[model samples]
Target: MMPNRRRENAIIGLGVIALAQVRSRKRKNFWIKNCLLNHDEECPMPLLPELQENNPDDFRNYLHMTDACFHQLFALLSPYIKKRDTCMRTAIPAEQRLIATLRYLATGRSLQDLKSTTGISPQALGLIIPETCSAIIQVLQKDYIPFPSNPQQWQDVAAQFQHQWDFPNCGGAIAGKHIRIVPPPNSGSDYLNYKGFCSIVMLAVVSATYEFLFLDVGKNGCNSDGGAIMQTEFYKRLQNGSLNLPPAEENVEGLNFVFVADEAFALGENILKPFPMRNLTPEQRIYNYRLSRARRVVENAFGIFSSRFRLFLTPINLAVYKLNHVVLCCCILHNFLLRNSSSYLASVSTDEDPAVSGPAEEAASRPSVGVMTGLEPGHAELPSQDAHDIQQKYLEYFVGKGAVPWQEIVADYLI
Candidate 1:
């Protein structure tokens, strides 16, 4: 009877061992089928060749710039962002890293989508994108957006304005744009703009050539444009007369050389705005038209910039510090593309001849003016006597010898 019991227990133990083996085989086969390999060759991961093989238009559409521009940008950033391989993992090629970063900026795609398309893990991309942007700024900021350190440099900018917009003694066009962003936690409505979205103001001074000469970003969207500019270091320098700006005599007999801006900015000796159109002679109206013309350069700069880096088309979801780096990097990249004589710049002529129509009329007609749609008088002081005097001088210049041939016709047609 005891021998019979031991034999039965042995049989039960053997059956249990056989069942465990079968279950282990099933699990191993499931893992092999589902996770061991990619579904197909093409689905494995994206490669650089797949993007480059497409036509030029597709390349630009995908990367937001021409191959030449991408190559140039990659060259500038490669040294700083390159990585070395380790035993655990192979390093991503510099070209791949740059292309990935540009694709992210160009499309503003989700990291998951980017991971699938670029063959980068979302975890790695989370680290790579910001690092790439920081590397780009570190590499290009000095050469692309250098502050004018001499009177001659500022004069050259003024010369470009005179040749292009026919507004003399102008340094650069100044404006502010709201970069939409997702609000951080517990921050209240500090980032909420009048436009009913969270945003940060990107204040910039643009050259006639559509380059950003100076940029100050990350101001709260709720603040007025004038208030935002006051918070920048540039404002302090301007107030102290230490920004290497030309003397007041260089612009006109009595007026200081100035930047052209909208009415939201304060009227300062160094900044020129249009006369309020409330009650004006033909001369003041004409002066407003001319100033608006020069100011369009900065407006166009913002247009081209947002168009190129469509990331700005949607609200950025990064933290404030990261958004700052991204915005400044885009500004620098804009200048870089302009410097490189990109086809994008060539396609849109910045020097469009202002014929019979004044700049304000032309600006109103274009859809791009939506970028400057939110203009309002800021909490700035009233126009100073010197600023008014400068406006008067410019008004006289336009009505006098500086007038173009069609100015007389437009002047009569306007009022």
Candidate 2:
């Protein structure tokens, strides 16, 4: 009985070996026919497909990929980022640092809260936020902002404004916004420079398509818009006559094509403003209406910028010097989104006219363009005669040219 049991076990082992040999032979034959012998034929063995679905929308849904998106953005921007050797030696990996920083910006979570979510320590998070912001600003200042390089580019931008917003020969819309920041350490009266809480000033120009044409950061909130504009590099260029803007054409009432701002910016002949009147003439009203309609591009641009950065939506707890870097980075990303069609502006309802009231009441109400409000802090009011003269001149020019009526223009182009 013992011999029979041993023999049975041996037979079973032999059967297992025989089955393994058969399977091996089959696999070998399959490989030879499909992969080796038929070299010209496509391999039958399944290959892993490349993952091509890493888009911003999809990546934004997942935490890891969201992290990766920031990583990729920072990686592309590495060369522009500057850091001290001491900081660099102790710094975390660039990719990790960037993702963590962006996560903070996007979510507005506390640094302690971010530790669990981003898997970074609180101390590392604090350092990474400022460092990464600095790097982003350097990259953006170097690469992204579109300061018109030539007369032709400026003309092209003007043409776009004319076609899209019916503001013919206009350069861009100028405006200023406050960016909240962390109060500086030992800041007393200096903190008073920022309004409400710690904050900085951002002055920007928005193009016809509601994209940021130029943005400058680091002005204290207490500075008047006029003061900030005077300090801007763009303004410096204009003052130095480095920009090749043509002299105002006689037909356009000798108004050189340039960005029109509120009364906050001191106007020479080039930058035009409407007559400041408690009441305006029909033609003056129409001209102001058109100008206001066109200038809404800047407000919309700021709305989009704030929505994207969300960090600007709330006060940040960072030093004033670091605040400048943060503002710069946000503006750079704003331009990138505009260029790439990845920004909130690209997805917004461009059809809605910000100047118009309710569309539902349109049938009952004549379309009335809203009036321009206060000038930037510390700017002189426009004289009524000068405003009326400018208005009449522009209106007559538009009427003579049979330019699209503001209402028709809004209906056809804006909607």
Candidate lDDT scores, in order, read 0.77, 0.62
User: Which is the leading candidate under lDDT?
Assistant: 1
Q: What is the TM-score of each candidate against the true structure?
A: 0.85, 0.70
lDDT of 2 by residue, 351-401 (tens): 434246443332223222222111236655444565545546676765556
Error of 1 at 77 (Å): 1.6
* lDDT measured at residue 358 in model 2 versus the true structure, 0 to 100: 42
Model 2 clashing residue pairs (backbone): 182-318, 275-387
lDDT of 1 by residue, 1-415 (tens): 9999999999999999999998777444342222213422333334445656667677777787877778778877889889998975557767777888888888888788886677776677778889999999888899989679888888898888888878787888888888888999998999888878888888888887878988988888897878888888888888898878888666644456888988899988888887776877777777876787678778778888887888888878888998899888888888887777447665464535646456455544332554433433488888778777777777788888788765554544544
Per-residue lDDT, model 2, residue 125, is 72
Q: For model 2, where is the 10-residue window of minimal lDDT?
A: 43-52
Q: What are the root-mean-square deviations of the candidates from the true structure over C-alphas?
A: 7.6, 18.8
Q: Model 1 lDDT vs. the true structure?
A: 0.77
